[model samples]
Each structure stands twice: as C-alpha cells, then as structure tokens.
Target: MRQRNKPWADDFLRENTHLVIPSPSEHRGKWQELFGNNNPIHVEVGTGKGQFIVGMARQYPDINFIGIELSKSVIVTAAEKVQDSDQKNILLIQENAENLNEIFMENEVSTIYLNFSDPWPKKRHAKRRLTFHTFLKRYETALSPKGELIFKTDNRGLFEYSLVSFSEYGMLLNEVSLDLHKDHDPENIMTEYEEKFSAKGQPIYRCKAVFRGE
Candidate 1:
C-alpha cells in the first residue's frame, strides 16, 4: 500500500513547481561555479515526502531550503512534491545526514531541522540515534556560530535523551515546547510526518538548541 502511494506522491511533486532544485551539488567550492549568491541556507534532515521543507520555501521566499533524505524512493517523492510547488528557492538531495559535513561548508547553514529522526530505542543502538553527541558535533561544525537546530519528535524518550545530550555538550537551549502543535509557537512548522503523528493523538515535542559563541 505504501509503495502504491509513491507514484501519486511523485505525480503531486511533478505538479508542484515550488519544490524544484536546479542543482544541489554545486556548492562544494571545488567547482569553479558558485550555485547561488550568498543566501542563508536552511536544511531539513529526514524530510519525509517533502511537506515541511517545501512548505517553508513557499512561506519564506528570501531564504533557501534544502531537503535531505537517505532513502532514494522517499527523496524522489519529496522531490516530486517540491516540483509541484514551483519554489525556486528549494533543493532536494538524496544523502545521509552523517555525511552532511562534507556536502556543506563550515558556517554555510544558518538553520537545521531534525524532524522525527529515528529513535534507535534499543540501548545497544543508542549511538545510531540522530541526536547523539557525535551527530551533534558534526552539525556544530556545519552550522554557523549562531545557527539554530530545530528538532521535533513524537518520541518522548528521544526528546528527553536529546535534552541531556545537548546540555552535556554545552549547547544552548534557545526554546523548547512539550506540545508543539498546541503551543502556538510562531516559528513552528508542521511536517507531513508531524501532521500524521499528531492526528493519531500524539504529542509533538520540539526544541531549538544552538552551540555557544565561537
């Protein structure tokens, strides 16, 4: 059933023009060509089906948005959704978050979104959690000194563990909400996964954490 939805998803993306990315890999600095002018970049990891990043690009025309997802099939769906939106300021990339540091230059990204990352609930697999200290360090390296990380999840344990992890790393907690959908936070965005999970009567936990001054 889920696989059946892929075509429709791709079709929707094709119809939406706003979710298109001209070229995503032109920013390596090794290439003689610079892709876009110095626009503040915002990234969303695990952008399931493109609802969140594409919506943000449509809402904020000034800033640029990049949606990175590990699954090729999923990213293709996301790309299609973005294509339907016709947003020139957005880009879609098929890549894992762990290699993010290589794809982006230091201080290149202004903001990042970690939406419902895998919890890796098993004790033995704790290191694989997206919010783990190692991953956070990579994010710190990629982010600008003032860059912010907007993390949202339906898992309470992951949220709690992430809170401690951020604190231990000396990252500043700029904002947090136990129930994101109900909190009325102006900056909060509702993603495809977020809408589905919340529809199931789940509380959405979210927070903004940032690395301290350089």
Candidate 2:
C-alpha cells in the first residue's frame, strides 16, 4: 500500500524530536541509559500507527518499548499517539529495519515484535520480508541470548515461510497459533491492522520463537 503524503509530517517530527528520537544510532547499546532504567527493552519492528507499542507500554509499565518505522509520514502518526499517551516507557525511531544492528548492540534487545508486516509476496521480493533469514540474523544479534521474537500476521503464506525460515535458522518455536483471536487472549495487544482484519473474520496467525545458542 502506498503511503499518503502528510504535508505537516516534517514539522511534527521536528517539534517532537523527544518522542521520535533523533540520532538513534549514537545511543546504540546505551538504550537503557536513554530510558533511564534497566528494564527489559522490547522492540516492534514495523510499529504501524503506534497502537501496539502504546498498548504494550500501558500494559507493561516496567518494560521499555521502542518502535522502529521507516516512513516519515506514517511515523508521525505514531509519534502523535505516543505523545498523547504520555508514557515514559515508549520511544519511536524513524529508521529502517535492515539497519537494526547499526542502532542496537548484541544482547541489547530482549524481545522483538513483527506484527502484520508486508508479506512481499512476489518470489523475487522474498528477501524483503521481515522474517527472511537475513532479518532473522539481525534480530538474533541484537536480541539477548534467550531473547524472544513474537510475530503476528494475517498472511498465511508469509507465516508458513517464516516457520520454515525459523526452523532452518535453528530457532526454537515456543508457541504457534493459527487463530490467535479464537482464544481471546486478554493479554494480547491488538495492532490497528489486527483489529481491522480480525473484525472481518480473518484468522490471525502468531508465533513466538527464540534463538538457539551454541
């Protein structure tokens, strides 16, 4: 889906540098210092519209949440939500997921969330998928030794591909759900896309996996 250009996005980002975070790479491994706490850090790779991150931060006050989004137009909406939430535990970064290692050091992140990411369905674009092996390697490096990766999506093909990718990468699958909303998990924080799809009776697939250490 093409993003609609928001004319005021630049000004909004400039005014809310505190929430959107400028020069994120400079902070690198010192994220704990930036958050002013030693609490575990959880990241949402494509935090669309900030719903999931904000909801997660509200539910887990002790855990720090960082949202990475590449679009200036899309992230502006997320930054607005974060500012309105007034939650100290949530931060946003307008950065590409491919550069995850550049912004975080090994063992710096405790958990990574991939929620409703673009499937990049074309065979030629398979590498662009967030669950592709290359991205998995980046996540593995940045995550702690026992760090967990939670993924949710409405795309069956992408979910299957991710399962195969995770298996090939030697990651252990902790949990897999083909119909996430069937159980109506109270702890589950729904993203904007999740709500839209699930409301239309679409099945949501979710999985939690951890890297296998040598």
Candidate 3:
C-alpha cells in the first residue's frame, strides 16, 4: 500500500530535531558516543511509524536503538512518538537501507531487524527483496562478528523465500515460527502491521539468522 504524502509531515520532522539524528554517517563508528554509552546497538530497517522500536527502547534502556526509514512522511510519525515519550536511547534516521554499510561502520552494529518488509513478490523483482542475496551481502558487511538479523512478516511467500535465501547465504537460523501469535510471547513487541494482521487472525512468521562471516 502506497502511503499518501502528508505535506505537514516534513514540518513535524523539522520541529522535532532532537528526536532524529542529523548526518548519521558522521557518527558511524561513534554511535555509542551519541548515546554516551558502550551499550550494544540494535537497528530496525523500514521501521514504519516506529511503534516496535520505541517499545523496545522503553523496555531495554541499556541498548541503543536506531530506526532507519526512508520516507519523511512516514518517519515523521515515528519522530513524533520519540518526541512525546521519555525514550532517550532511540534515534530515527531518514535514509535508505542500501547505504547501511556507509551509515554504520563494519562490525559496529550488534543486531538488525527487518519487520514486515516489502515482499517484492514478482520473480523479476527478487533482488529488491530485503532478504535477497545482494541485501544479505550488504548486511554481512555491516554486522558484527556474531551479529544476528531477526525478521518478521505476515507474508508466507516472503517468509519461505527468506528461509531459502538465508540458508543459501550460509547463515545459521534459529527460533523459526510460522505462527508467532499462536504462542504467547511475553517479550514480544508488536509492530503496527503485526497488530493489524494478527487482529484478523493472520499468523505471523518469524526467524533469526546469524551471518557466519564465511
């Protein structure tokens, strides 16, 4: 679903300057300095509306969270949530995920999250998928030695595709779940899409992969 451009969103983002980081690449290797601690950094790609990242920040104050979203119209809503809340460990960046390696230094990130990413279901569009080999290679370059990528989605086709992709990429997979909500997880933080789809009895698929750096 394409998001309708909200002209006011740009204004909202401008007003909440502190909630989002400026010149994210400048602080690539110094991300901990931005948070004033050496805590592990966790980032979410395509963090729509920022519910999950904000919730995670609130729950785990010891870890730093960065939300990478490309759309100003979409990330503005996330910035507003950070502005209204007491979350100091979170910083939102309006940047493309393709430039993640340049935005953050190699082995600097501890974990990466891909929540309900665009499926790009067409066969010709396979390379556009977040879990595609090209993107996986980029992630491999940016992730720490033992860094892990956790992904969640309601799309079964995408989920299956991701499993095959990860395995072929030589990543170690764990905690595979085809029906996430069916098993009550106290530690689970629901994204906006997760809540919407789960309400309609949709089962969420989840998996975690560790890049072997092979």
Best by TM-score: 2
Worst 10 residues of 1 by lDDT: 28-37
Clashes of each: 15, 0, 0
Q: RMSD for all candidates, in order, please.
A: 3.8, 0.6, 1.1
Error of 2 at 92 (Å): 0.4
Candidate 2 C-alpha lDDT tens digits along 53-128 = 9999999999999999999989999998999999999999999999999999999999999999999999999999
For model 3, how does the per-residue alpha-carbon lDDT over 5-39 read when each residue is reduced to its tens digit? Answer: 99897677677767777678898899989888999
**TM-scores, in order shown?**
0.86, 0.99, 0.96
> What TM-score does candidate 1 get on C-alpha atoms?
0.86
Clashing pairs in model 3?
A: none
Candidate 2, superposed: residue stretches over 4 Å from native: none
- Ordered from best to worst lDDT, the candidate numbers read 2, 3, 1
Q: Is candidate 1 or candidate 2 better by lDDT?
A: 2
Q: Rank the candidates by TM-score, best first.
A: 2, 3, 1
Instruction: Give the worst 10-residue stretch by lDDT in candidate 3.
Output: 9-18
Number of the top candidate by lDDT? 2
Alpha-carbon lDDT of model 3: 0.91
